[model samples]
Each structure stands twice: as C-alpha cells, then as structure tokens.
Target: EPEVTQTPSHQVTQMGQEVILRCVPISNHLYFYWYRQILGQKVEFLVSFYNNEISEKSEIFDDQFSVERPDGSNFTLKIRSTKLEDSAMYFCASSLLPTGSEAFFGQGTRLTVV
Candidate 1:
C-alpha cells in the first residue's frame, strides 16, 4: 500500500532559525494535512490543503507557518522561525476524501528546537 514519507526522522535546530519539514503524501489522495503533537499533548491540526490551496488552518498556523505543494508528489511544511515551544512530532497525512474517510499518516518528523 502507498504511504506518506517524511524526510529527516529527527531534526534539531536552534531557536529563531528556520526549518522546512518535507513530506510525500499518497499520490491518489485528494486532501493533505499537517498535524503536530507537542510531547504528551494530543494531536493538533495545523493546516489542510486541497487543489493546491489552503482549505483550512488553525490559529497555530500563524504567519510563521506555510505549506506548499511544490510538485504533484510533494507536500511541505515550513516554519519560518523556530521556537522552543515549537518542538514536537509533526505528522503529514492524506485522505482520499474531505471527510468520513481514513487518513494515512507518516511516521512523523520529530522537530526539536533548542
């Protein structure tokens, strides 16, 4: 089965720096999303994209965060500046439908901002 793949399973960066987390979602899926878990916290939705546009986004996805589908097969999340509180396990997910469907998630990129 096809699955989402993320680069650099673990990333360590200094505060105030920038980081771009890359992902390759399932090819046939129509909806893509970015989610994050801050250590022991529950998964929080960051943003959702469809048709190459942002369909939805949470307050957490402020001006500092951006998502892009640079190509047909790649989806990426970029944090313009890193903060200590931004450390978390960021997950990339995709679903065939907008709702009521299973979303496949990648192993996640563990981002640690020092």
Candidate 2:
C-alpha cells in the first residue's frame, strides 16, 4: 500500500531560523493536511489543502506557517522564524475524502528548535 513519506525524520534548527518540512502523500488521495503534536500533547490540526488551495486552517497555523502543493505529488509546510515552542512532531496526512474516511499519516518530521 502506498503511504505518506516525509523527509528528514529529524530536523534541528536555530530559534530564529526557518524550516521547510516536506511530504509526499498517497498518489490518489485528494485531500492533504498538516498536524502537529507537542511532546506530550494532543494532535493539533494546522491546515488542510485541496484542489491546490487551502481548504481549512486552525488558529495555530498563523502567519508563520504555510502549506503548499508545489507539484502534482508533493506537499510541504514551511515554518518561518522558528521558536522553542515550535518543537514538535509534525505529521502529514492524506485522505480520499475530506470526512468520513481514514486518513493515512506519515511517520512524521520531528522539528527541534534550539
């Protein structure tokens, strides 16, 4: 079965630097999303993309965060001006339907802000 794949399983960056996390969702899935889990916290929704545009976003996805489907198969999340609180395991997910369906998730990219 095809699955979401994320690059650089572990990423370490300076507090003021920028980071771009990448993901390749399942080839046939139509909806894609970015979610993050702070060390011991619950998974939080960041944003969702469909039809090459942002479909939904949470407050957590402020100006500092952006998501893009730069091509037919790649989805990416960029965090500008990383902060200590930004350290977390960011997960990439895709689903055939926006709701009432299972969403496949990647292993996740652990972002560590120093």
Candidate 3:
C-alpha cells in the first residue's frame, strides 16, 4: 500500500518567521487537502486543491497562508508569518474521488511557534 509523506515530521519556528510545510500526497489522486488540529481540538479543514487550483478553503486559510503544488508530486503550505496560535499538527490527505470516498492522510507535521 502507498501513503502520503510529510517532511521534517516536526518543526519549530519563531513567532514572526515564515514556514513552509511540505507533503507528497497519494499518487494519482484527484483531490488533496490540508487539515490541522490544535493541540487538544478536533481536526479542521484548511484548504482543498484539485486540478491545479484551489477547490475550497476554510476560514483558517486566510491571506496569511497559501498552498501550491510546485510540481506534480509535492504539495506545499506556506505561512507568510507565524503566530503562537498557528501552532498545530497539520495533516495532508488525498482521495481519488472528490467526496464520499476514503481519504488517506499523512502522519502530520507538528508545527511549534514560540
């Protein structure tokens, strides 16, 4: 079985710094998404991408953030500026079907800002 992979399993950044979280979503999938979970909170959707454009996004994916698939294989999330509240475990998920299909998720990248 194949799975999504994220680099730097954990990251530590300064409050005002920039961070780019990287992920390689499942191959041959049609939809890809980024979701995050605050330390003790439920997982929440951040953004969804398909066909080289953003298909959907949550409020949390404000101007401060952006997502792009620079290459066909890697999906990246960039935070222009980091904040204490931005710290969370970010997950990358992909599915062949747009909806109603099982989404495969990466282990998650834990971001810590201080």
Candidate 4:
C-alpha cells in the first residue's frame, strides 16, 4: 500500500534558522495534515490541507509557519524562524477521507532547535 514519507529523520538547527520538512502523502489521499509531538507531549495538530488550500489550522501554526505542495506527490512544511521550543517530531498524515476517517502517518521528521 502507498504510504506517507517524510525526510530528514533528524534535524538540528540554530534557534532562529529556517527549516523545511518534506513529505509525500499517499497517492489517492484527499486530506493532508501536519502534527507534532514535543518529546513526551501529546500529538498536536498543526494544519490540514485539501484541494490545494488550507482546510484547518491550529493556533500552533503561527506566522512563522507555512505549508505547500510543490509537486504532485510532495508536501512541505516550512518554518521561517525556528525557536528552541520548536524542537519536536513533526509527522505527516494523509487519508482519502474527512475528519472522522482514519489517517495514516509518516515516520516523522525530527527537528531539534538549539
């Protein structure tokens, strides 16, 4: 089965540098989302995209964050100014469904801000 894939399994960045995490969601999926886990914290939703536009976004998706689909299969999340607290495991998920449907997650891109 097709699955979501993320790059940079681990990343270390200065406190104020820019970062871009990449992902390739399932081929037939209709909904895409970004979620993060801060160490032992619970997984939190950052944003959701569908039809090439943002469908939903959490407060965590502040001005410093942005997302894009640069190609047919790649989805990317960019942080313009990374902060120390931004250190976390960012996961990409996709589903050919709505909010109530089950979603599949990528291994994740670990971003460590120093």
| Candidate 3 TM-score, C-alpha based | 0.98
TM per candidate: 0.98, 0.98, 0.98, 0.97
lDDT comparison, 2 vs 4, better candidate: 2
Relative to the true structure, how large is the alpha-carbon lDDT of every model? 0.97, 0.97, 0.95, 0.95
Candidate 2 per-residue lDDT, tens place, 8-103, comes to: 799999998999999999999999999999999999999999999999999999999999999999999999899999999999999999999999
lDDT of 1 by residue, 1-114 (tens): 899999879999999999999999999999999999999899999999999999999999999999999999999999999999999999999999999999999999999999
Residue pairs that clash (backbone atoms under 3 angstroms), model 4: none
Clashes of each: 0, 0, 0, 0
**What C-alpha lDDT does candidate 2 achieve relative to the native structure?**
0.97
How far residue 13's Cα lies from its native spot in candidate 3, in Å, is: 0.2
Better of 2 and 4 by TM-score: 2
Model 3 scores what on Cα lDDT?
0.95
- For 20-106, candidate 3 gives per-residue lDDT tens digits of 999999898989999999999999999999999999999999999999999989999999999999999999999999899999999
Off by over 4 Å in 1: none
Q: Candidate 3, which segments miss by more than 4 Å at Cα? A: none
Q: What is the Cα-based lDDT of residue 26 in candidate 4?
A: 94
Model 3 weakest lDDT span, ten residues long? 25-34
